[model samples]
Target: MARIIGGLTTSHVPSIGKAIAQKEQESPYWKPFFDAFKPAHEWLAREKPDVAVVIYNDHGLNNFLDKMPTFAIGAAAEYHNADEGWGIPVLKPFRGHPKLSWHIIESLVADEFDITMCQEVLVDHAFTLPMALMYPGNIDWPVATVPVMLNSVQHPLPTARRCYKLGQAIGRAIDSFPEDIKVVLLGTGGLSHQLDGKRAGFINKPFDLWCMDKMRNDPEALARLSNHEIVEKAGSQGVELMTWIAMRAAMTGRVKELHATYHVPISNTGGAVMLFENNPQPHAIAAE
Candidate 1:
């Protein structure tokens, strides 16, 4: 049986990755962040889980105005890294694990999570930024990943409660996997910051830490927090934090803090990364 080994929450800002890769972590705004990620880098390598269920919102890349599925999972055998802006040098096709991808999708559908499964999806920074920022190119990402997309960039997104329920479903599905595997459920986005409109360049560190505390200690209240409230306090784009609630809900009480860090450099947003060990111990190697 598969068990969720732990969870990680990180900001997907492209500049965050660029800052680390360029070795310019000395930037007052960015230095604090690079230092914080060291622990996560060490921990993830130590717990070489078989699969990482990545929860992220696409920036009008895969799912656009043409049609957006509130929740989409990559079931494709391969995906391409088509950089959709902010300094992505180039893109290479990302190979997928169809066997596991399809298995999870089918399980989610059976569980009534209602997800959009992609056979051939192109991922932008939403997926790649995590690779560059947290995992970095230097580390080998051996685990298979499942990309879960939420509609945050556009309106008509799923409600906070709804996303939370979906996370629960993911947990159930992973546990149901017949083979022995360790899963890493990652919810990436937010820390109270906005990136557009008249109220751009907002950073609410107090609220960010509050949300993290509530997420770890009292999730019910956090889950109940309204989308409008998240936007008002976290910033307009910060509504994306709804996805984090889902990840928290799935993990429930099975969580342990490994590392935590938050920082706001440029205007219009704040970036943060917190890592946890879902269980006491996980393998340094996993067979997907």
Candidate 2:
């Protein structure tokens, strides 16, 4: 049976993509954030998961405010990345696992989650940047992917609890699949920052640190928060933390925080990278 090996959570700010295009990773402004992924790269090298289930929010490349599904999954055989007016260079198409995607779709529907299935989806930077961060300098990606997008951009978004439940359903789906493949979950976006409104350029360091701690120690506390509460504390755009919560929920087993790093003011966002080993033996929480 297929099993989840671990999860990775990181911010997907578009400027990170531009930095990659300009080869600025080691620059003073970018090095702290970029260097944090070294341990994650080492972990991936050691585990070498066969599939990556990326949970992210679409930024108008595929869905718009007029017609956005609360939850969507990519079932296509290949997912292409396009320039979403960010001026970042487009990435090559990522190979997809249709069989696993279909299984997950069917299982989610059966679980009454009402997910939208996309056979052809245009992945924007939110999806691609995290992949690039995980597999740096690779022209071709190493693992097959499944894009699980949440609607963090629109009103009436899925509540934190609902997103957690959706992730639990996804965990069940992956566990029941017959294939003997290893899967890694990638939850992209947010620690805390706001892009617009009167609170524009906001960064809540205390809240970001608190959320990160709860993610590793007591995610249930985070899930209990209402959408309004999250926006009020984390800023409007910071609601993207739902993707991180969902990724944590999908683990469905005792998790270990293998490595984590948090840096502030990355394009007005609180950039964070956390790696978790799912279902670690002897089941004890390690100090973060």
- Report the C-alpha lDDT of model 2 over 8-122, residue by residue, as the tens digit: 9999999998899899999999999999899999999999999999999998999987779999999999999987984888999999999999999999999998889999999
Clash totals for all candidate models: 3, 0
How would you encode candidate 1's per-residue C-alpha lDDT over 1-288 as one tens digit per residue?
777888887777666556655777777767787777788778777877777778888887677787778889898766777767666554445556677677778888998877887887777776776765656665455667778888897676688888888887887777667778888777887878787888878888899889878776777777687778888999988887876887777773357777787767533467777777775323412433
Top-lDDT structure, candidate number: 2
Residue-level error in angstroms, candidate 1, position 193: 1.4
Clashes of 1: 3
Model 1: how far residue 230 lies from native, Å = 1.3
Model 1 TM-score (2 dp): 0.90
- Lowest-sum lDDT 10-residue window in model 1: 279-288
- lDDT of model 2 at position 198: 90
